[model samples]
Target: MMFEENPPSSYLTRAAHSEDSQETITAVSHVLQDQENTRPVPADNSKSFAASGDLPAKPISPQQRLARLRLLMSRQKAEYESKIASLEQRHRELQWEIRDTHWQLGQQRQRHRLAEMRIRDAERAKEDAERRNEMLQKEMEEFFETFGEINRWK
Candidate 1:
């Protein structure tokens, strides 16, 4: 519709730098829509709005269009910043969760090491107990043999 009203030269000059992305297309559409929404100077070339709309037109010159676009851009920028702040907060929360998980893993490793040491010490103690029992059995057998031989001689 804009191409139909405005000459190819006017629109093409502005659109020359735009690419095919949807966002870029949408932004261009918004500018085109904004420019078209203004009242065309009354065919008689008078500056008054009495001929058509109840309110005076918003953009009459290149400067006016620039100002209007600046205002729109500023508003969009503020919205983007607010959304970014929320994302940044989420990022920080994720980082904290990562730290907590790492700490828990460290604690698990320490507990595992302690359990291994206790098991090793228990095995050594068990070996020592077995050796002491074997020695006691040998000494008791020797005492019984000696006492039995003495009783027999008497």
Candidate 2:
């Protein structure tokens, strides 16, 4: 588990500011541009094999090659489907995790709100107590003054 003190934007800024990363990005862009300029050569039956001066050996008939291509394509399609299914499963898991995190955050917010309310109530109670104490002190002072006058008259 990793504890992150800073927010996501800071990490993004750090990544964007790296000089080595910029050079790497430029290199990758150039490589991709070169790839865009390159084209695949079509299969030519008349082309001579590079290793041998003779024509390229035809391993299978046209029909057999077509069947092979179909099989390969189907295999690739199935592989892609499996990959997609796994990716979808992972996406669902991530979504559930996000939902759970949001729920936890909501619960925390509710708890914090409740705590704030309790604190406010406590503060009000403290004020009321202080006011009551002051009133009692004033009453005690008045009682003492009345008792002193009565004693003086006696």
Candidate 3:
């Protein structure tokens, strides 16, 4: 059986389903049973494999299978760690972006408030100037009337 390309899980599934010889099926089943019994329990850290460095309970003389399994486990662990690091970095970047957006929003709000205040101030100044102009015009009218009367008397 050329199962070099397929993973163990798929290989086992294919073997189990195919119409292979009874002896082959029995041998594969025994191997799978042994693997299940010897599989290490999952742990929180990557050091789990290092902590339990014991070989399988039924050690096969052909070290190829054991070495292949170890290689697969290591590759899986490395992939998971890489994914976790990438996600952590992405999370940090998103947090910084959120903070920057919040700061920009606050700045825009402040600027909007300042603009509103300036508009109000400008309107107030315009009203005050109009009132002063009205007062000056009335005073000038009164002075001109008084001057005309004095000139008529002269």
Best by lDDT: 3
What are the Cα lDDT values of the candidates?
Answer: 0.69, 0.64, 0.69
User: What are the clash counts of all predictions, listed in order?
Assistant: 0, 0, 0
Error at 93, model 3, angstroms: 2.0
Candidate 2 or 3, higher TM-score? 2
Tens-digit lDDT string for candidate 2 (40-148): 5447634535643453354444354335435645665687789899999999999999999999999999999999999999999999999999999999999999999
Could you tell me every candidate's TM-score relative to the true structure? 0.53, 0.57, 0.53
lDDT accuracy of residue 80 in candidate 2: 73
Lowest-sum lDDT 10-residue window in model 3: 1-10
Give me the displacement of residue 91 in model 2, in angstroms. Answer: 2.2
Whole-model lDDT for model 1 versus the true structure?
A: 0.69
